[model samples]
Target: MIPVPTGARVWLATGYTDMRRGFPWLALQVQEVLRKGPLSGHLFVFRGRRSDLVKMIWHDGQGACLFTKRLERGRFIWPSVAGEAVTISPAQLSYLLSGIDWRNPARKPASDAGRIAAFTV
Candidate 1:
């Protein structure tokens, strides 16, 4: 579970079960919750009922931060609607935002470093 620093307002939407069953309407959901509430300067998270589509919206005073992620191989595990909010680790968020596979890991070598040998071996 990722702990958002205290004093930062974080709202998680884990209503996937209900959302799926109710045929969640994105426009209506955003309007009713995001538009009406003090969403400004707050972090909002949403997950698709079936797919691995996770959407996040946040207002950082200057502008809104919108984040979305889709897993290419496997579907992300979603929380039960009965739960209050699913906790995500900061590391997980970073990986998800960067389009890196959090499940399967790989790293690329640095390409900017100069060659070690002055002349070709």
Candidate 2:
């Protein structure tokens, strides 16, 4: 999940689905969806019913890029399924997408130069 640009909104789809299955039928027609625009440049995020797998689709001028990730031991930290679309900061999205414990309150201590040097050896 990436942050939508300022003044720009992302239409995130929570349900996991075969994006290809829907893109061909729904990409061109955008009247009923959350954000209506040409599918060529927008970010589309999808998750499985279990919230374990995530897939993203985007078009970067020249071609489309697809990204997918599956967790080995846990599920993706998904937002509450209350609204069709929600605004999120770039930092929150990054943490959620990276499989980090976003809900944890404790922060990991930053490693000092001594620790870094030890690892380099």
Give stretches of model 1 more than 4 Å off. Answer: 1-6, 17-38, 83-121
lDDT for residue 89 in candidate 2, whole number 0-100 = 49
Count steric clashes of candidate 2: 1
Per-residue lDDT for 72 in model 1? 74
The residue-by-residue lDDT of candidate 1 on 20-48, one tens digit each, is: 32213433355564452334455556777
Q: What would the TM-score be for candidate 1 when compared with the true structure?
A: 0.48
Tens digit per residue, CA lDDT, model 2, 43-63 = 666667777777766555676
Error of 1 at 70 (Å): 0.9
lDDT of 2 at 27: 49
Q: List the candidates' TM-scores in order.
A: 0.48, 0.61
Q: Clashing residue pairs, candidate 1?
A: none
Give per-model CA RMSD. Answer: 7.7, 4.7
- Prediction-by-prediction clash tally: 0, 1
